[model samples]
Target: MKTESQLNIIFVPYLSPGHLNPMIDTARLFARHGVSVTIITTPANASTFQKAIDTDMNCGYNIRTQLVPFPTAQLGLPDGAENLKDGTSPEMLGKISYGMSMLKDPIELLFHDLQPDCLVTDLLYPWTVESAAKLGIPRLYYFSSSYFASCARHFIHEHKPHERLVSDTQKFSIPGLPHDIEMTTLQLEQWVRTKDEITDFMNAAYESESRSYGSLYNSFHELERDYEHLYKSTKGIKCWSVGPASSWANKSNEEKANRGHKEELAQEPQWLNWLNSKQNESVLYVNFGSLTRLSHAQIVEIAHGLENSGHSFIWVVRKKDENENGDRFLQEFEQRIKESNKGCIIWNWAPQLQILEHPATGGIVTHCGWNSILESVCAGLPMVTWPMFAEQFYNEKLLVDVLKIGVSVGAKENKFWASEGVDAVVGREKVSKAVVELMGKEESSEMRMRVRKLGDASKKSIDEGGTSYNNLMHLLDELKSLKASKALEKTNLKI
Candidate 1:
């Protein structure tokens, strides 16, 4: 074996906050377990989590970041526009995808040069399956979402239940899942509803997953044990549930605050002070994640809704342009709320984990992103689930119907964030009602209790001798044995 000390694994994270952050956290967790870990990404993308990696290295963990050139200029994108959050328009997003595709060859070459024992890459990079095979290494597909979503998608794709529906609003049951999950055609992504180029890409990705050695999920065994069972039995792949990775990796407030992006906001203290001023579990936190741009009308409705709900809130607003349509109205609303001391509007990029862990934060208004859901669950907070696109609707079902910890805002359409318009906007009344129920109502007490228990389970899952911890140890042993077996085969051939 070529191993000097321990098994070496390379993590290839996709270039986005939701995907990038947790993958980096998982890499750090692996490093903490005495594995040699290297994260390979473009320079601009690496800059987002470089500080966190540096901290791990300083702590004497065997972790490092390897940089590659981001083909921004070649793809006609502006410098530093290497992440999905950097793409302001559909055209720019296309350029970013094309640029990412251009890196496949260079990344494969690195795979050959590094000669790691295993390749753990984002689900987006389906091509890596072949690269890992060429290098005679195991490839573990990194799924950043829940196992419930994965099983739901698999059944939906296999059964084609949505295809039999008459209207987009008609509900149908997904077949062969452990839980009875129902979803309307409107809730599914456009690619699932119809055949397109994206559909082909997704199909290729899943096929690659099935062909790979195994998969890694950022989920815990207790959170979705039934769905986890269903996923493995049907897909017939070896997998590990080692997650709540954020909590396990960033154990302290300082590490949580500096988890992603190095920029220090001048208004950080203001928000922290605002959060500190509130009572325990008294404030609502609203964020639509790194993607998901709301229209001007939607922003105005959200503003009115939060104001009318009679709750203290800290909303992370991602304004497209200073002169955009709702700029004047948002400015006026911010001033009024500021003077009233009722709400705080953070311009962009709030410290999410820090805010969630704060004692003052009670509930969340989330776009049903998996990362956001896990973070909230870990914080023991219920949610007002507003699913916009992707597998979010499935996640919403897990929260509202299965978990019973979320109140849905009754969002009806599933449009991509960039393509969202006023047509699918949940009115201010719906928003206000959901928030009131999630934050103030007596029924919310039960929801809080259930989530708190789950939060405790999430913490225990990562401790020594826990399910996730044991799974990690087993996976490492398997990788090391495989490496030794390969070395024996080579020796036999030489003899």
Candidate 2:
């Protein structure tokens, strides 16, 4: 089974933008390094990766897509509602999880036919571990969060420090991690609190991850060298922190140091050109990734905050979100901002990477999503943390506490702003101050320098002979060795 014809790998991503994007980047990374990569996802999610896959193939890299029908009818979901981003409500999100779980049989069959050298999958597909084992292939669990979050989760699972606390709102120290990070019980994920169906799924996922050959994370060693080493020492899992995976997008342009950020550029060429016309480090970029909905009050506050901060900004307001409370208020505010000519409102879907890379961009007001965090680091932009849900609060801790490159807008209570009412809206005054501090203050100059250094390190990480580059090479060698050993065992059994 060990063929010297280039190594082939299968990547199975969960049906969420947060999960699929980084894994797709990692798949492309492998392809650029001479590995044959096939990314398998539902038909609905397939289009998101198709353009990148086609681009890679045209460049003569071995990358392709395999689409399976999502169980929309079986799961009572609407047509084409395969991804979490498609879910209109929390109840629908639960349905998406149910639908993803139903893919076990189909994925197993595909594994039987593809017979890849190794399996790489999102943590959601726990059954893939068994599937890989059945086919005599190794499995690597892909974690798309920060090493700090990983270290916290790993320790929290082992220790149960929260059990001793009385209230869910009470703050507690995360035990066993190298960092002195403290998060409220409220900030901890819902699954981490109780034993529900979601908890059950997570337990199965963690069990499968532990049983697999190793874990792969979208982080680089230099970013969290201490937590990186601490994770391996504590978990005893063969782990690879060959990431800041957004950097992988640049690996193909080994010649042009500029082409890696092209994936998101073509979507809005005009906006990028406009951003370039602004002052250096003068434009504050505000975007709450995709899926975090904002209430009317929240949007108005941010509008006033950005205007009051007196910094030119490019704020991305998702078109769907504009209809959430009242489009009139948003329209009026947009007109005021436009007349002032200090702000640009992207109705929906702007070129995020290109805007981030623009020289005029100074600070970011982000939801603290891990992907955004890595991208911000790559661009060397300081941030104003506004975490809305999930492990994003943990990532905020890394940004504000460990990295010291951000100021929190102080969203201490953890709840999805999508349904959580107006209590979550950070006041315009706080937002104004955070923006002013990040974009103008002398003290914030340290944050600017620190983040720029991280940006440099991130760029260095994927270049030839870099930390992530070597780690990726080592992972490939491990897979090849495992393949040869499996083939030897197969031959011996035949004898």
Candidate 3:
């Protein structure tokens, strides 16, 4: 194996914080290993990009970024649309779809100007793969999701559109997927749902995913061994699950500041102080992730559940109140807490990774987003999963069904109750039971052991001489090997 490196990779990610974080972290990893990287993304997400760039100094890698100009106005989004939290909206989705078209030309320009060795990109961006093929650069798909999500996407594309594809109430097992991954329409997230023309669009994206050279999942092979051979054999693409990438990015902000970077460390001293007062595994860390929003009544129910459960908890509430811009939700939530006097700390945001890594953190009560799920797994924390939408339901299945790593908050039955802002059908009794069970020593310890073991395997997979490390090497080798092929060098459209 060649020890020295000579590759310059262009990193492109789907412009969301959850997607951007892991991609930037991977770029840092490549940089740490002596490979040069220039990240490609829109100017809309410049803040997170800046934060990521600033944070990279601590990881011992610094990479440059080229912000592409996007038509933010045409999509009916605000001037700073990228900064807006990721949510389900037709307008936002349209902007992304339109921006993707614009990205094609910009990416082509970047490829011509940079002449980078390879393109490392999210599988969702079709233009990246197309541009790489036209420019004859090897493109490796950097999936910010888990192996289960990747495989499911591929399966959905390869198989013809079926009844379940359109049906919301059907629960069925995927033909080749592991375990009895029983899934229902209520459990299906947005990505699995058929909304307007998105189904056809996603189908095309999946097709692109199937045609890539290789893939890198933000997970360990041991965590999803059932699909290892299937992922490899499907596209003849090298698949590597090297993840819990957070461990690599969690270095102290002080170290980063020492390297000419200002640290935006989480203001977590208050929460930590609270944790200090609790018994080990006693506090339930409640967060709905970065993107999910709850209506006023749903927030109250959550408050009710936390209050009735009679546990000292930290709840991260993104307040949604027309009267006061969500601050009211927190205020009302706090009022309930005060009346009950249960010692619940209500915050709009928390230091998610630091909180998860804290020894006193017992379990995560989450919205079941993959990023949150992986972070929980990486931090060796079990979950009380309340999935909102998108691939989250699928992720919830993998977590609760296959891995036994978490529990799911089932769906709401009454449409009016849902319209009236009910977060879960799980009443106070179920909530208390889930809390007791999740916070129980035996269940928590078992889940912790499994998650910690997976976390360790994830670290090893990314380390030198590991399965994922070798896969990256092999991918680079294949890309380098294709560099001089006359067939690939031509600028003619072959597809």
Model 2 ranges off by over 4 Å:
1-5, 251-270
Q: Which residue runs does candidate 1 get wrong by more than 4 Å?
A: 1-5, 265-268, 321-323, 418-421
Per-residue C-alpha lDDT of model 3 across residues 1-495, encoded as one tens digit per residue: 122235678988777666777787677767766666788877756555466575565555647778888766766666766533633454665566666666677778988898877888886776678788876667777777767766665665455233445565656666567566666555544444546566666667667766777677777677777766667776676666656565654466443222211245445565666777667667788987666655555665666777777676787765332236346666766777656545566454566776677677878888776778877877778888876666766677788888888866664321211344344445656666777778778756787788778877766776788766776667666655665454454545564
| Candidate 2, residue 350: how far the Cα is off, in Å | 1.8
lDDT of 2 by residue, 326-377 (tens): 5988888878877888888887666567677778888899999998899899
Steric collisions counted per model: 0, 0, 3
- Greater-TM-score candidate between 1 and 2: 1
Q: Estimate each model's TM-score.
A: 0.97, 0.93, 0.84
Clashing pairs in 1: none
- Over all chains combined, what TM-score does candidate 1 have? 0.97
Clashing pairs in 3: 168-185, 190-390, 319-326
RMSD of 3: 4.9
